[model samples]
Target: MFKSKLFDSIGFIRTTFLIAFFILIFLASITYRHIKELDKISYSIMNTYEVSLELNQLISYIKDAETGHRGYVITNDSIYLEPFIDARENINKSFQSLSSRIDLDTVKQKQLSRIYDLVDKRFYYFKNNFSSKTEFNNDFRNGRIVMDALRKEVNKMLRNENKLLSSKDRLYRYNNSNTPLIIFSTFLISILTLGYGYMRVIKNYKDLMNQNIRLKIFDESSKQAEILGKYGSWVYSIENKTFDYSDNKFRLMGCEPQSFLPNSDNLLDNIHPDDREIIINAFKDIEIAETFPLLRYRIIKKDTLEIRHFKTAAKFFTDRLGNKNMIGTTQDITEDFNKTQLIKLRNKELEQNNKELTEFNHVASHDLQEPLRKIQTFISRIEDKEKENLAETTKAYFEKIQEASNRMRILIDDLLQYSRTNRSEKKFELTDLNTIANNAISELSESIKEKNAQITFKKLHEVNGIPFQLEQLFINIISNSLKYSKPEIPAVIAITSTKTKAYEKPKLKDNSKREYIKITFKDNGLGFEQKYAKKIFLLFNRLYGKNEFPGTGVGLAICKKIVENHKGYIFAKGKPNEGAIFEIYLPV
Candidate 1:
């Protein structure tokens, strides 16, 4: 956010400076024009004064000629004639100068023409009267009249010149007074604009400084996370064709950070020889590919010279400047890879051991049960035919042998069943619990009757399962209840079913939203302590000794295995001397 705002502020400052620059240019242009106007007005004022001065000079020369002529007319002096003769040439020169000055002004030029005519008539009197005595008095009177007329005309021209001079002076004063304020206002506006731009720049600079500090802290934290996680990140910029390796990236190669530049060749040098071609081919399409697929290979650490497994994956994205880049992380998976291989090897060995054990059990079961059957057959014949001759003590020993043989036969049969249950290749079919429960009850009908036990159930749920296994599960659970029943009270077993969600039963500890058919078996038998609920389902985990309980401890274990085979869960709950409950959940 700060970076974006900073860019906006920079653009604003540039625009402000641009506006200020144009204002400066405008101010210069206006000031220069104002100066030119003022200069023109000043020149006009000077010309007005010069024209007035020339008119006054012309009058002075005519007056000098009149004064000298008067002196010569009374005393007849030749020096007076010299003054009169010089005044004529001086008056003509003054008239020429005044006409040139007022030529562009029509009104002023007409007035100057009248003054020139008056002067010419006065000069004609001076020459005409000097040659005739009778007309000399009249000529002198006429010359004096012309001289007075010339003075009046010259004074009129002077008044007009003075009026023009006053007009030009007022205009010059007005322009001179306004120019300074106009220029000053423009300069001040430019200064204020620059000041605002400077303040904005300062504020953005401080914001950028704070943001930079935060970014540096974030970068450091990311580096630490990479190092601790045994992973390293790298970036490939397609536009620049450049690579950037994080500090941990170099460390992953067992080299110090930035020990060498990041590039394809340097990275490939650390890869195992057999995997080098794979890594090389993967990168060859990096420029055109949108992403890098997950790749696992082996690399030789530079410092340790040890081969370690590594896996890398990356996705391609375009930066704000439209530069294509791919960022990927490479992890040191040597420990995980070795553990995975070990598990695979152990799994193979365990599978082989189980197979051999199953074959042996198959062979040994037939051999062992045959001998036990033969022993039972021989013992029964002895007991039947030689009972009368046998001593009571001998009969008691024979009974003990018979009991031992029966227990051994049951144990051997249970072991074989367990081995078959452990095989994963058993075929599954849609099986109904109602039918399985009825079949199991019928099979154990003799024992149920002997214990006066009631095996009751409603319509149970159907499931995809191994049919024989389900029947076996029911038979074992019912027999267990019958065996553990209190001698005072008849055993009562209830099988019930309901549909429920997995999360509804906390003991199931599953969070799936799928529905399950829960089948519960409640028995009013000598249930063990609640603490031993989970232990009862483990193989060979019997609560009572063999002398007290006739069970081989494999019944509930087989039940648990069958439930698991159908992707179901089995849980047991018990209360001492009260009853036990087994709940099984199977997917619908």
Candidate 2:
């Protein structure tokens, strides 16, 4: 009874196997047809690539020949002419190669024949023109026209070849859809033949489920990270060779999700106009090195025109298909950039405040001297009349008080003038320095005569500055020169102006446009050492003591402030006992 049952099961199994085998054979026939179609398409594609390669070579040869021709013409060099001949010969060879590869399609064959005829005609014409000395003009122009026509024909053929290549690519892609179906059917038939196939199928199903779950988790984590960090991730598609950005990335770019396309142009358009070329060059560098580096740039928002700073770290990823994908994170660093700018602004503000305070101290001290001087003079007048009536020690004390008051008054006045030097809120007007200088000299005419000082001036320029301030500047400088003159020598002051824009500090103004001017003041007096060049521009900074030269040491400091307020700079150069030169650069 058991043998009979086993025979019966074996017979049934054989019948089932026969039916499955027949079905497989039927499917195999259909798969074979699909595969044959794919092979034909692939062959067509290969032929197209061959034609394209040859045509491209031909185009390159022609360009080389043209370049060589121009070079030889420019230099009249026989060496360059040899290259031109070589390139021309290679052009013919490349055309022959293309011809052998391309099939006899009516449109392509016609275009190819026309190209051959034109090439031959141009070659003959160019060869004849090579030795012709008859003022090569109109004939050479005709040759160019013929060559251009030939190039156009070749281009047309290339386009046709590209179309064919595209067609083959599409066919192959469509045929590929049947491959997976055929493979799955074969797998199914094999599984049906194996009795333990169900166990394998269940295992594969479980593995697929786990893989999908992991993929989902990864995606969720990436999205969460992007949102929290205000960063966006991007991937490049190998098939399309295009960039794809995540939704978060679109948001970060200040663009709609649908509008965001990962491309060089789109990204560059968002960059600050000034920084666009810089960012583009950086991207090219990465592409050439096949490396990814962190890039920072400013992006101008499209709608709002608000600028935002962004930082990105990018690297190229090659997929299994050997296609490049650029993956990176984009982050907004606008706040950080703004904070840096704000800190710089605050530092500048603090510096300005400190300068203002110094000026105020000088002015306040100087102004107080007037009242103090009045007090001292009145006390002296009263004490002078009663001096003999008092004790000898008392009279000496009164004389001492008078001397102290006089010194104090001088100190206060000097401080006051120094503080007010460049702090006045007066508008600048066009003032001629020559006129101003003469007027300043006239005001000090008595002093100049008394000291027997000689002041000379070069033709001064018309500059935009306050007249009063300029007058004061000249007065202080001239007074210093007279006070520090070499003993027994007449004070000689030489003022000259040079046309210069060198080192002119740009003015901070609402308008973008402005002009500039330059002037210099040179004096022959008791000059100090070069080491004190910058130190001289400080309050109470005197190179000599009161006994050597009487000054509150505020003149140069006031000069520096005035020059700076005029959006100019002042620098002094001198040697001990030599003359001093002060150069001022101003933006008008």
Candidate 3:
């Protein structure tokens, strides 16, 4: 539709140009005719004015000569005859000038000739006066009659010239009036044509710019796709025996783009010696095979001299002309391949480290515990035996030693337990959480009773987990609530469990499509600030000094490790003086 509209608009513009061309031609012709008519009228008007002026001068000169002749005849004065001589000199010149001017009109020319004859006859009468006064008067009267005839002839010529001037003036006025309209019409047409052409040019420029922008966007999208996928495309024509590789393909091979045409030989030359055989065999079998699975190999980069991995997949297709061809995609998987290798190496290292740690734990457990236990026993004995005999300062020092010894023992024990979590065999079993909670409470009975703690729980769902670890997890959490209970307020810890999908719990950070048991432990205890929630789970990380709250700080860390062993997560939410909650998620 757009294309059709564009063509239609172009057609309209062309038609408009053709029409404007004819308009200009017509305007030009009309203007030429108007100018020609104006020129002719101007010429006629000039001739009429010239003829009128010359006829008036001739009449004046004739009247002057007649007056002077009359004065000379009356007084016979030579001064009076001066006017006659001057008039004679100028009259002939005026007559010649008038005749030349009015020559274009034959009627005017004849009138002018008659006027000249009458003037000449009047001058002859002035020059040759009759001897008698009567003859002179009679001759003067005849000259007056001739003068009247000359006046009528001059008036006739003037009238004829006036008519010509009026007619030419009308023509000139008509042409002058039309000239403005013609010029305005031409200007309007020219403006419209120029405006239309300018609009077309602007429209074409905008369209070209828009098309350029779209092409650039498409180019950017293509380049982004190549970069994101770490892959490039290629085609091999079997008939022509030519290979075509994409720009990114050359870049992936650590070579500058467009350096050279890609061929099977150059490609194989870059392949590692060990993988070259595999690639060669794969291509050799392509003619017989319809398709193949992904082929992976390694190459030594020319620029960096680094070994890199590449993978490709190809399929055979027949062109419309019945020529066989292969189209394929090659990906630079070096980063991913290197990451996998690094992970394998890390896992091996971790395994070896874990083994060595387990051995150290076993040795330390035996070697350190016996000595620590003996020291605690010896301190207790000394505290009892020398309690009354020692001075107050000595007794205070003994208490310090005893406290240090006790703390040392607890540290060694907790350290041993924390290590065992990673070293122990993961023996998973289906066990009731309620049973686990009851066993944990039973083990912490002394602390619960001392704190007057109210531990509440209902029958919880059974889940797949290590039974001993789950029990230990509950025991540590319950013990924490009992130990940290605010003074003068009875401790209250509520245990609850609900079945839910893993994704439903936002804090789990597990997106697996599996069900889980969300077991929560809420307590009304002297909870630490929420900021220390994660820190508390780290081994030996304590929020308070030993004088304020005596602990190894390894209980929560052990709980975290145990939960991890069961493929679960445990996190805490706490607010000072408000309360604390520990949420545990175990896959069901």
Candidate 4:
């Protein structure tokens, strides 16, 4: 019965294989014919491209020649005659090039020859008329006739070429229409072949009942272990001398199951030399005592020679027939190991960098403050002691120095604030942004009063933020609005906020929670060009001169730093002469 069943299966497989072979033959024939058609189409396209290029060159040459001829006729300048002469000399070459590319059809060839003859005749008449000092009107009339005839012949050739191109394009469309049918047929054949293969597997399982029963328990347990550990198993039979590998087991070894089989000797050979002995001893212990069901080691990939860490556990099991089988699983731990090492190295480097930056900022800021203090002190002394005795120009110079010193002081303070923002720990809480905006407005009351600015506030939302930093951000932005107000209009400052639900807070290193707050600060000020919107955030960037707007350009820079420290972003939008709007997005 078994022999008869085997013969039946063989016959079935043979029939299916024959069907597959015939399908492959059909596919190959279609592909071959398609390739030939494609080659012809490609040649036709290249010829068309060449012909078009030649025609364009000819047109350009004719236009240049006509321009030069007209200039020489009007101005009687010999210099203008050079281009005409050069074009006349090159005209024959262009005609020859076009003639060479024309199709070998008699009509097309004859048309090209006629065009060439007419162009030659026109050139000869032009040259003779110019040399003999013939009347311009007669020469022009004859030249027009010859050019017209030549143009007619060229147009005829172009029509024939375009017809041929259209035919080729239709052929391409016809071939494309057949492609979908061919692809569908190929896919159908593939699906039928795969179904046949699946059926064969099922039949084999049914016929090999005893062997299947023995493997059933082992396969299920191996699969369970693999899923639990993100691993897979393999086995090498000593007596039968056959190798078996699971799908994931082959993947862990960086090999295909059909290409490489797992074996004791092959596995050992692929292991890192330093880890080989360790794995061998572990395997031996498991085999001898049958006590442990797990072993772990590192192996090197054959292609990359990179060490891949692995952990495996296995046991020897005997069937009812006393056949011994070894089963084991391997887990790849290379990624986990590498990630741990990377974390350690990065943490060390970051700690060292943080220490260096902290010291640098402290020393740099302290050193810069001393010189600024001396300048301020000297300027104050000059104004207090020598005001009346000094000349007007000298006094003006002293005032300028004092203004500069004051600006420098503000810059230094802003710089310190910006640097401190980077190091300050955020203390997030529900804070009223309306109160913050009011406080900033109150702080700038003197400037607002001087400028006669009309400031308005809408109901602002309470958002999650560091209160002090939020307050500082509000002050800088509001102060900027007052400073750059339009000369003609009262500065109109509007403050408003809206809750944003869709906003995502940027993740911190510790993976903390965040929220979002949307605030808009609009001002009717001497607005800048839109291009300067982003640039205004950079330190020391000023759109207007100090005489026009007086402030250290660090205000926006500080606002940007503070917003970023609070896990937020600020963007400006404005057009020349229009009002500026600053949008701030804060994460709660």
- Leading candidate by lDDT: 1
**For model 2, how many clashes?**
3
Model 4 regions more than 4 Å off: 1-308, 311-329, 339-355, 386-394, 501-515
| Candidate 2 whole-model C-alpha lDDT, 0 to 1 | 0.74
Instruction: Please report how far candidate 4 places residue 207 from its true position, in Å.
Output: 7.1
Question: How many clashes does each candidate structure show, in the order listed?
Answer: 0, 3, 0, 3
User: Which ranges of candidate 2 are over 4 A from the true structure?
Assistant: 1-245, 249-374, 388-397, 503-518
Clash list (residue pairs), candidate 4: 294-313, 295-312, 515-588
> What is the per-residue lDDT of model 2 for residues 1-588, given as tens digits with 9 covering 90 to 100?
644754565666666666667767877777787778878877877888888787778767766777777777778777878878898889778777776766566677777778878877765555423545553665568768887887787788778878877877786777577677876877587558644334544555576688679889999998888878888888765446477888778877678775856775566778888878767776665545877667888888776778888898877788767877778788987888789899999999998897879766865785676688788878877877776797888878887888777777767776666656645677889999999899889988987998898988877888889888888777777777777777777878888776544334443232444455556667677787888888988878888887766667777777777787787777777877777877776666
Better of 2 and 3 by lDDT: 3
On the 0 to 100 scale, the lDDT of residue 417 in model 1 is 84
Per-residue lDDT over 1-588 for candidate 4, one digit per residue giving the tens place of the 0 to 100 score: 866887788778778777777777787777777788888888887887777677666656766677787787788888888988888767768767777777576876777677667767776555423544455666788877777776776676667777888998897887588776986788688669857966985787677786577689877887677656667767756456466878767656666644765556675777878877776676574445754445567887666777788877667787667777677667887777789889989999998898678667756876799999988887778778878899989878878888877878877777777777666778888999888888888888998899999888888888878888889898898888888888888989988777654324342222344446678989988778998889999988999888877767888988998888776778899977788999997775
lDDT ranking from best candidate downward: 1, 3, 4, 2
TM-score between model 2 and native: 0.42
Give the higher-TM-score candidate: 1 or 4.
1
Residue 41 CA displacement from its true place in model 3, Å: 75
Q: Write the per-residue lDDT of candidate 1 for residues 1-588, one digit (tens) a residue.
A: 756777888899999999999999989898788878777877876777788787788888888888888778777777888777898889888878877877898988888888888988887776523656758888888988998888788888778777877787787777578768878998998999999998998887787788888889999998889988889999988776667889998898889998888776566888999998878878887777675778999999899999999999887888988889988899989899999999999999999998888888777876788888999899889889997797999989988998999899898888778777776477888889999999999999999999998888998888878889889888888888888888898889999999999888877788878788898889988888989989999998899998887878889898888888888998888998899998888887
Could you tell me the TM-score of candidate 1? 0.77
User: Candidates sorted by TM-score, descending order?
Assistant: 1, 3, 4, 2
The residue-by-residue lDDT of candidate 3 on 1-588, one tens digit each, is 756766777777777677778777877887888888878877877877777887888888888888888788788888889888999899878877877766677877777777878787877777545689888778878888888888988898789779878877876786578677877788689669867866876786687688789989987888779878888888988667678887787778878876887776676878999999878778776667766668999988778878889999987899878989999898989899989999999999998888988889867875898988888888778777878899999989888888888888888888888887777788888999989999998898888888889999998999998888889899999988887889889999999999998778777776767898899999998887988989999988888888888998999999999988988889899989978999998888
Off by over 4 Å in 3: 1-232, 237-267, 300-308, 321-323, 334-366, 373-403, 446-454, 485-492, 500-516, 522-538, 541-549, 564-581, 585-588
